[model samples]
Target: MNQTSAARPLVSFDGVSKHYGSVVAVHTMNLEIYEGEFLALMGPSGCGKTTSLRMLAGLEEPSEGEIRLDGQRINEISSIERDTPMVWQSLALFPFLSVQKNVEFGLKMRAIAVEERRQRARKWLERMEILELAERDISQLSGGQRQRVALARSLVTEPRILLLDEPLTALDANLVVRMQGVLARLQKELGITFVYVTHSQSEAFAMSDRVVIMSQGRIEQIGSPKAIYRSPASRFVADFVGANNILSGSITETGEDLKISTAVGEFHCEKNSDRDFNTGDTLDLVISADLVQISMEGPEVQNSLRCRFISEEFVGSIVTIFAELEDGSDFKVQARQRDLANMALEEGAAFFASWNAADAHLIGGNGA
Candidate 1:
C-alpha cells in the first residue's frame, strides 16, 4: 500500500534476541522491513512486540544475532546515531513548549542552523495542516493536534525509516481513525519504511502492508492482512485472529480431503496443506465464523450440524448468531443483518448448521 517492494529490504533482523537476566524478552526474531513498506507489529502484552521495536530503534541491544539498516550492521549503534525516528505511545513532547518549538526540538538537538530549523519546522507544520497553531501550547492542543505535532517532530528529520509505538492509543475512536489516515498518507507520500507497533488487530490490518503477529517472545506469523486473516498458520493464530469456531475431533479419512468425526457429527474438510493425516488421528478444525451458512431450508452441504441457537447479536450491518452443539461446545455463524431478519430464529430454537468442505482447514492433528 505504501509503494513497498520486495527487491531490497531497508531493515533486517537476523536471529535477534534480547534478554533481561533470566527472562527472554525477545527470542530469535528474523524479519525484514522493506523500503516504503508499512509494517505493523501486533500482539498481546508481554508478547515481545515492543521489545522487538526497541531493538530496531537501538534502545535495546540484542543478546544474540544482528540488526541491520540498509545492509549495515547497527547492533552497536545508539538511538541518537540511527536515522530512525520513533513516535512513542505516550507522545513524549515538551509540555511547556509551543507547537513550533516542539516540532523544531529534534532539529535543534542535531545543531541544524537556527533559521533552517525554523523554516523546516514551519514547512512540516504546514504539511500537517497545523501551521496556524505554531504558537499554540502543547497542552492547549486537542489530542489529534498533539498527535500531528509529535509526528511532525519525528518526521521533520526526514529519516529513511519511521517507527511508531501505539501513537494513537490515548485518542478516542474517531481520533484514532483520523490518525490512521494521517500515518498512511505520510508513509505513502514520503515513500519511507514505517514500523508500527500496536495491540489492536483492526488498526494493524487497516494500515500495514504486512502484519507481524507475535506471541510469548516469538513471532507467530508474518504475512499480509488478508493472508493472516483468511488462512491462519496455527491454532493459536486462528483463535487469536478472529471469531473462529475451532473443532477438535478424530480424522476418519485422509489425503486430498479429510473426514473428521466429532461429537456433533461427521464433517469433511478440504486438505489445504501438505501435512498428512492418518485414520483415527486426532485433529483440530478451524472454520471461520463467516464461512458457516444459515438458511431457512435444509440444503445439501458437505459439513452440516444440528445446533441449538444460544444467542444472536447485531453489530452494524452484520449479525452474529451464537449456537451450541450437542456436546455443549460453542459455534458461531456470521451473516448479513438483512438476511437474519427473515431467518426468524429465537433463543433455544434448533437450526441446522452447514459449511462447505473447502471452508474447513485441518490443523495440528497431533496436539500442536
Candidate 2:
C-alpha cells in the first residue's frame, strides 16, 4: 500500500521498549500512526501486540525509549488525561446501571451538567442504534447490544484516539461480522485514530488501513493486509498471514529471473531476485494454498509438481486438498468443493499442482 503524504501521523513511537523484570515484552520499536487511520496490531498470544496497545492507552509505560503524540512526548501522560479511550474485550459495563446511565458515566466524571450529560448520552446511544435499549440494564442486553453500549460510553467522551482490545472476541461468528461493520462505519464517520489489537487475521484485515504483525515481542512486518498476504517479508509472516506451502530449495541461477532447484523439481520464481538470493544461495519458497491449482493432467506452467493426494477437508464453501510430493514433503491446495468434485479427485489419485511464477515468494535463508 502507498503511504499518504497528506495525512501526518498523530502518534509516533521512537525506540520504544517495554520489559517485565528481565523478560522483554516489547523490544526497541519505532512506528508512526497516521491520523484517523484504522491500524490493527495483530499477532499470536505473547507477541506483545496487546502490551503495545496497552502502552498506547497509557495503561503501561515503556521500560526504555519514548512515545510521542503529534510530536509531543506522552510517556508520562496518565490514562485518563490522554485524549484516548479503551474498549475492553469483556465490554466492561455496569450491571446495575441502565445503558443511558452507563454511557453518561464518563460525562458525569468530567463534571458536565446533569441535564447536558443526559442529552449528549441519549444522542450517542441513539447514534449507536441502542436508543431502544436506553433504559435496559446490561444483563438484559444481547452480546451485540452490550458491545454497542460499551462503544457509546467510550465515544461519548469524544476522544481523539480509540483503543480496542479484541472487542469482538466474545461474539459469535455472525455477530462478529456484523460488529465489524459497525466498528468500520463508526471509525470512518468519526475520523478518529483507532488502534485495534486482535489475534484474528480476518478481523484485522477487514477493518485496518495497515496491519502491524508482531512475533516474539518484535515487529515482523508492517503493511496493508493485501501486501502482507501477497508478499510476506519473512517465513514467519508467510506462515502466519495465511496457509502457505513452504518448499525448501537452493538458487541455481539468478538475475532477471531466479531458478530454484528443490527435491520436488526445478522451478522459476519471479520475485525479489535482486536482493534475496545469490546464484548459489538456498531459500524457502512460500506459495499460498489458494494460489495452487490442481489438475488431473500436467499443464504447461512455469512451475508444476506431481504429487499424490493424502487427504481432503471440506470447510463449508471451500475444500482443502492435502498432498505429498515425491520426497514426502506435504503441502495443501485450496479449492471449491464444486471444483474438487468436478475433478473427481480421490485420496490416492495422482495430480499436478501448479502456480503462476509471480505467485511464488522467496523467504528466509538456507537454514529456514
- The parts of candidate 1 lying over 4 Å away from their true place are 1-6, 274-277, 296-298, 366-368
How many backbone clashes does every candidate have? 0, 0
List model 2 lDDT by residue over 84-166, tens digit each. Answer: 78899887899999999999999998999999999999999999988999999899999999999999999999988899999
Q: Give lDDT tens digits, candidate 1, residues 1-368.
A: 54334457788999999999999999999998888889999989899999999999999999999999999999999989996889999999999899999999889989999999999999999999999999999889999998999999999999989999999999999888888988898888998889999999889998999999999889988999998888887877888887899988998877567889987788888877766578999878888999888766656876888788989888899889999988999999998888777676988988888888987866776644
Let me know the TM-score candidate 1 reaches against the reference structure: 0.94
Instruction: Go through the candidates in order and give each one's C-alpha lDDT.
Output: 0.88, 0.89
**Structural similarity to truth (TM-score) of each candidate:** 0.94, 0.95
RMSD of each: 2.0, 2.0
- Residue 93's lDDT within candidate 1 is 90
In angstroms, the error of model 1 at 229 is 0.5
